[model samples]
Target: MPHMFTISPDFPPNSLAGWYIFNTWFQKNTGLNIHLNLYNSFEEQTIAIDNNKNDIVYVNPVDAVRLVRDKGFLPIARVKNRLDEVVIAVSEENPISMMCGLKPDLKLAMTANPDVNMISMMLLEAVDLNNSNVVKTTYDSYIIVVKNILKGEADAGLFLAKAYDDLSNVVKKQLKILLRSDVEELYHSLLIGPELADRQDEIQTLLVSMTDNPVGKGVLEALDFEGWLKIENEEMEFMIDLIDTLVPDTD
Candidate 1:
């Protein structure tokens, strides 16, 4: 048996069933025994990658930029499945400008994913976090956050695109969208590791051709990915801009 490489999945332990299917698929396809270090939170996943507890990790674009710049890592490819979205919503009766008018006193809820940092930065840019009324509450899952807003526990909520689609009926009836993020054009969710930078060609080939193999095909489908593509340097440059434009001056 060769060295067993590890991947920190984007999804929690077996939460999507397909994640494990893809894990097995990639392991068999690459001839590298693969294992998953399950994570319940994005913070945990980011820390695991930062500490070298996982290899060839999957991360959202925000975290991806952080890993590459802060850790001198490289991305082999981005996930073909791009489900991340940022939603800014308010209750129907409340005017959209109410939060800004209130200044640091308005209540907001957001998904607890570290990648959500990008969304938060956008909102802060629109309104000063210090000058405006902004109180934040976090939930482990986006669905819970949606529920909180629906039940009047929260004044507004930010959620992923899939969650927004799932809650379409309720959103239309009771909530209003204040803002939506820009579409990710070259947004490959990113497959990366510091150690694999030199093997970019091989990794990209394996991922793109995996579909031709039965096991590889299964993993691709499980991950909700069509296939991986070679990332251009320009794509990475775009990510850099997104980060610079988004990251706060807390440094």
Candidate 2:
């Protein structure tokens, strides 16, 4: 019998497809059984982890910070979210000449849930939230924010790399990049949970040693994962400092 490891997957295409491919590869190469549990939202996944529901999970940067503090989970690898450009979008016609000059009256659309929008808020505070008059537009998902902007409900919107990629030709053409943050060297999608921590060496071996075999290579190709990197507590501490400066009261 093989030790079965469970992963909390977020959504379809990227989440399910990527997990299935990686799970197939991991089992064949390492002889450890792999399973994935799909969730409708990151909220569900985060709760599951807190309740000891799964062995591992794929978390976003914002959630990764929370896991580091609350769950004491170790990061084995980061899913490279290729699109690095964080866009400051305004109405296509607006003449916002500079990043600093963008008005305080700019109504911003952001997700109400912390799991999805906390990182963006952290990024904004790092830039200068005190000076800006940002009206928070709440929604269930980030896609709703894009629609609010197109309909003239918002003056500007914050979006990740993939949001721009998935935009329609018209919407793509309509939006202007008001500003983009400096490139982040590494944005981690950490693997969390107590089970993974106890079996750290085994987990690391399974991820890093994958490329040695044919089956393992297939999963790596699907996930676009180069390999695993052993992240230290000090690195996670840097994120702690950043979060502290942004949301001091609660991590």
Candidate 3:
């Protein structure tokens, strides 16, 4: 069977084509049978991981903990200059002028995406809001989260920064961005499972050098990445530890 490669569903939907192109590029270069398996939601992908051996996977910070610490996956590379940031927003007409002004019994829309949820909770700490104070409505995607907020179903919504930026101008104008997290160190990474340990050096080398060629550069552009950066072991551990500290045990 071909080695399966998949990306986190939290990635921009528009990048689907680029991933396909990347799969083709990877196969051509290494002469390996690399299949690009896709999942529409994070739950679907999680279920898949539990069911099968995914040789190469690209996932966000939260999922990385499971893949690395639990599943024997090694973090190889991450996209350069692409950090996972959260944007908390509300309907433009809402009277809540500041983050701290948001009070209890508020309706909050968000996805079950762990890192975003964790960061959102931490951000709300500025206002002394806890999960108990706000009633959170989980959505399948950021689009739905924004939709709920705009329709008054939610007082505010938490979104992945990239997802929020991808929204059309028409949609963005009706929503007010309350605040965005500036966590500059966290990002999604391309990881290789234990089964592919032999190819670690090869995969990492190709990824980091993609910027040298036009075809690879185009693929990077399609994914909205400037380039790839090698993730050192110590730095990777630091990122995981930081996440543990930022989010409490109760969260």
Candidate 4:
């Protein structure tokens, strides 16, 4: 049977097709029959994960930790230098200069990315803020999150740093970044299940050495990656440990 390769639904919409292209490249290069599966919703994906055996995944930090710890997946690589930082922002007119200025009942706009939300919540810890103390309004994307803040429906916005960077200069100037988390180590990763255990080294080498060839360079351009880099087990463990320390499991 062909190996199942899945990507997190949180990837930017523009990059959706890029993953398919990369899958074709991967199959061509690796001479392996890999099937790509992109889920429409996390809930639907969760159901599939519970009943299925996924061979490979490119996922966000939150899921990365989950798969490594619970599903016994092996971290192989991450997009080059792609740390998953969170950006907390407020409207230009709002007077909250620092996170300390935050208080109970402050309205927050955010997307459904749990990793970004978790880190944003950690930033709110500066003022001892938690979901109970703040009001959260979920948006379909970062753009809408900013829209809510600009329109005064939300007092603040939480964003993935790359999404914030992609916003137009005009829109960005109308808001202020109260803070951008700089944990530096949290990032998404490509992982493989035990089914691919024997081929781990082979797959890792192909990913990390993508920049060495023209075909590989073309695929990287489509995916908007500088290149790929190996995810050392030790580094991944520290990130998992940090996540465990930052966010404890609750029933």
Candidate 5:
């Protein structure tokens, strides 16, 4: 049976088609028949990984920690242009200058994902605000979170710095970042499940060497990444620790 490779849908569906092209080239070069599965939500993806239904997965730093610690998945490689920091943004017209400026009954907007929610909570805590005061309005994507704030449906929103940079200039003019989270240099990782342990080295080599091939280079371009880099366990320790500190007793 072919191995299953799944991706978290942190990005748009159109962008994810690059994985199909990469998978084709990967199968040809490595002689490994890997099927591609794209998940629309973090919850679905995590469930699949936990059920041992996926042989390989592309996950963010938070999910990477959970899979590694609880599911026995090994992180092999990471996207070169991974997210590093998140921004707390509000309308330029709003007078909120810092997180402390938020009213006791805060109407916050953020992506409906565990990692982002945790980061938002941590940022709130940093300013000595009770997270319980936050009335969260979840959006499927960062762009929507920004839109919700622009539409006056949300008082503030949290989104990745990169996503904020990618916003249109007109939209940029309307929003101002009140606070920038401390930089946590982290990457979206490619993890190998226990079922694929025997082929870990081979798979890692293929991914790390992808940029060298013409087809792989094209796929990388489509995926908006420079290349993949081999990752060390120690590189993710900070993220794990941050999560633990923010959310106590998280397994």
Candidate 6:
């Protein structure tokens, strides 16, 4: 039997293919029989972690914080292009120059994930938008959220700046960023569960040094990241505090 690692299904199909390629290379280099496990939702992924079914996992910032605080997961490395903040965008033709200019009947589109939803709520609060008047719609992906805005199904959308940058030029021209938040306190993280405690140092070394090889470089390119950076427990304290403040109670 091989060790199983879990990842969130938030990535697009093409991106998932790249991950499979990377996983194959990782197994070849590390001489470990590890399997890639993909879950369809955040809830399912977290449940696997809580049940001690996962060895290593890739997850968003909020889940990383939760797992660290509650499930004894250790943060190892993070994507080099980790997001600093999220953006609120409106269609260019909407005539809304500022977030506050948004009308009460605004149809807000956002991904259903906890981190994004929390940020979306914070952004709405910043503009003093009444919750009652805002029509919130949840989607599976940032691209869908942005598309809804372009198709006139949403008045505005919340997405990471990186996702917006990845949009097509024509799509980019049709949207205007109303505002961007200050540096986010959290980042997407690679985590090691208790099952991999003995192999922590070795795994961390391999991941951080992955880009030294051609196979690793190709994996990084496919994932749209420069490289991984090792993270310390102390470095994640701010993110933990921020998550605690934003969510209050995860249970």
Candidate 5 — which residues are off by over 4 angstroms? 12-14, 236-242, 249-251
Ranking by lDDT: 3, 4, 6, 5, 1, 2
TM-score of 5: 0.87
Two-way TM-score contest, 1 vs 6, winner: 6
Better of 5 and 6 by TM-score: 6
Q: Which lDDT tens digits does candidate 2 get at residues 63-109?
A: 66777777776776654344233566776776775566555566887
Q: Select the stronger candidate by TM-score from 1 and 4.
A: 4
Candidate 3 vs candidate 4: the TM-score winner is 3
Question: Mind giving the per-residue lDDT tens digits that candidate 3 earns over 192-217?
Answer: 88988888888889999999999999
lDDT of 6 by residue, 1-251 (tens): 78887776566555777788878987887798989999876667767877878777888788888788888888888887676477889999998898779878789998756776677667777667745678988877777888899899999998766666677788889999998777656678888877777777888899899889887899888887799998877877877987778873432
| TM-score per candidate | 0.78, 0.74, 0.96, 0.90, 0.87, 0.88
TM-score of structure candidate 4: 0.90
Q: Global CA lDDT of candidate 3, please?
A: 0.87
Cα deviation of 109, candidate 4, in Å: 1.8
| Clash total of candidate 5 | 0
- Looking at model 3, the pairs that clash are none
Q: lDDT of each structure?
A: 0.63, 0.60, 0.87, 0.85, 0.77, 0.79
Off by over 4 Å in 3: none
C-alpha-based local distance difference test score of model 2: 0.60
Judge candidate 4 at residue 32 and give its lDDT.
87
Show pairs that collide, candidate 5.
none
For candidate 3, what's the RMSD? 1.3
| Greater-TM-score candidate between 3 and 5 | 3
Off by over 4 Å in 1: 1-15, 81-83, 91-104, 120-132, 166-176, 183-188, 211-215
Candidate closest to the true structure, highest lDDT: 3
Deviation from truth (RMSD, Å), model 2: 4.0
Model 6 bad stretches (over 4 Å): 43-53, 130-133, 248-251
